[model samples]
Target: MKTSRLVIGILSIVLAVIVLFQSCAVGIGNALQANEEVSGSAGLMVAVILLVAGIIGIVTRNGGKGPFVAGAFYALGGILGLTNAGSYGDLILWSVVCFLFAAVFIIGNLIKKKS
Candidate 1:
């Protein structure tokens, strides 16, 4: 269980980085093109939040709550992206990936608690 938490913590941090980079890329591209703001800022904010949560989870792996909290944030971000599909478009794919990762962590945490 400890090992699994460590692995999940690392992966969550990696995913957070990916999401943050992707959000920044999109925001920069929009700014360079002089396009009106869209969902980029929201996505960026969510990514930043996720990144922070991931770091916290990594730091508090033994606490058992960090991963679950981070996973909930991931799931919330994914759902937000999905619900705002008109603005997010292709980003929804990334959201789906987030959902999958969230499910893994949340379920793992739950099962660990049960055992």
Candidate 2:
């Protein structure tokens, strides 16, 4: 359980970095050009959400509720990634990572109870 929380804490920082990087004009422009589509307003929103969540996760790292909140945030981030079909590979990757973390937390607790 503690190990899971540690991994989540680390992942939160990584997620934050990814969001911040995406906020760069070059990244946004490239994303737009790739699709030759609408601007990156929607992506920006998701990035902001991820940033906020990551910050919260870091702040609440030692709290008992940290994992729960982090899990929710991760799931939301994964969903947001999935919404951008052009980034479907990233979407699947994030979703799997988030799910695996949640599963580890749950299973670890269950095993501890049985011991």
Candidate 3:
């Protein structure tokens, strides 16, 4: 398991948690307010998906191709986020970070394989 992959996995999980908490907060706030708009479900779904992917990456990190699989999931989530930009502009940043992490995992793995 490469250190970079491990670090990326941990960061991804952390980011997922942050997104989840924000989603929950928004949901609760909306529920408490009669006129409040509901706008957290999308964020929640994205966070959950990312969380699952991060966990998968961590669990399979020793399997050689696990990081790549995880990276793909992250990239996909990021792309999906683009469609929900109206409610969450942070999605762009999240997507960029995810892509960068994926790139690191892929390039690192390729180098390791070649060596």
Candidate 4:
């Protein structure tokens, strides 16, 4: 359990970085071209949420309510990203990953409790 959290934490942080970089690159491209095919700000916000979720995951390595908390953040970020993804295929991928992580964290905790 602790190991899972650690792994997810590191993974999420890496995802956050990827999202941030992509968001910035897209935003710059849109700015240069004067277009709005995809909302860069929305992507940036989702990245921030994922980053926080990752941090929470890392801090919750003690195995308390950390998974639930991090899961909430992940879900929130995922939903937001999905809603605003527009033409950004990468955003959808990121959102899906975050949502899946959220489910894993939350469900893992519940299963542990039941066992």
Candidate 5:
């Protein structure tokens, strides 16, 4: 898998987690806040495309690393959405989530390569 793709895969997982958490928040205000964060249809479309790409990477690649790389691209697209269409406050939170997954992908790839 390519390095850029790996980074994106990690980001995808992170963004997904952030969205899930915000959506599940107990407060109505938080939920409403999440609603407002939605960007335009273009951003949404990008996220969907990234997701599809990630899935393809996972399924088509020979090694486990391929999926992670693809997933990073997916996350990068989500970050674009959260930063562009999503709320500023939510962007940081979401980016952090993306970062974490990116780290995982990086580590996983390194480990996989080492073996």
Candidate 6:
């Protein structure tokens, strides 16, 4: 596996954990003050995508399509979250991060294909 994939995998997991904890801290306690945090469901969805992508990166062979598909999922999930953010304004940063990761993975995949 490429070093980029490995680094992305670890960082994705770390990001997932951060998202999860933030969601839980705000959601579970029903202490959402001014809608400055992501909703529980949305956070869970994003976190799951990140976690799955991380796992795929760590375990899959170099040429497998897991990272490519994970990239697609990251883009899809991020876009959906951004579009449906509603009153949850704090979700924007995480959504943007997802897009960044998606871009990295997709661009890396394309570069590999060309080589």
On residues 58-90, what C-alpha lDDT tens digit does candidate 4 reach at each position? 998666788999999999989998898875668
Q: Between prediction 2 and prediction 5, which has the larger TM-score?
A: 2
Best prediction by TM-score: 4
Cα-based lDDT for every prediction: 0.69, 0.55, 0.71, 0.86, 0.51, 0.74
- In candidate 2, what are the lDDT values of residues 1-115, reduced to their tens digit? 5655666656756765664464455347757568653224434544565555556555655555554666576667556655652532343454455556555544554565567
Query: What would the per-residue lDDT of candidate 5 be over residues 10-114, giving only the tens digit for each residue?
Result: 455455544544434423443566664344332444445445554555453455656556546646755664556444355455445445545555565666678
How do the residues 40-113 of candidate 3 rate in per-residue lDDT, one tens digit apiece? 66567668767877787777766588767887887777666655544456656666776777677677777778
How far residue 114's Cα lies from its native spot in candidate 3, in Å, is: 1.9
Off by over 4 Å in 6: 29-38
Q: Judging by TM-score, tell me the better candidate of 5 and 6.
A: 6
Candidate 3: which stretches are off by over 4 Å? 25-39
Clashes of each: 0, 0, 0, 0, 14, 0
| Model 5 spans > 4 angstroms off | 1-38, 41-46, 60-65, 85-92
Estimate, for each residue in 11-61, the C-alpha lDDT of model 1 and write its tens digit. Answer: 766766776777777778778877675567756766775666566656766
Candidates in order, TM-scores: namely: 0.71, 0.56, 0.75, 0.91, 0.44, 0.80
By TM-score, the better pick of 1 and 4 is 4
C-alpha root-mean-square deviation, candidate 2: 4.1
Candidate 6 residue-wise lDDT, 1-115, digit = tens:
3887788888989988987786666466444465544466677677788788777766652756877887887897688668756445556777898888888888888888888
Q: Which ten residues in a row have the lowest lDDT in candidate 2?
A: 37-46
Query: Which pairs clash (backbone N, Cα, C closer than 3 Å) in model 1?
Result: none
Q: Indicate the worst ten consecutive residues by lDDT in candidate 6.
A: 29-38
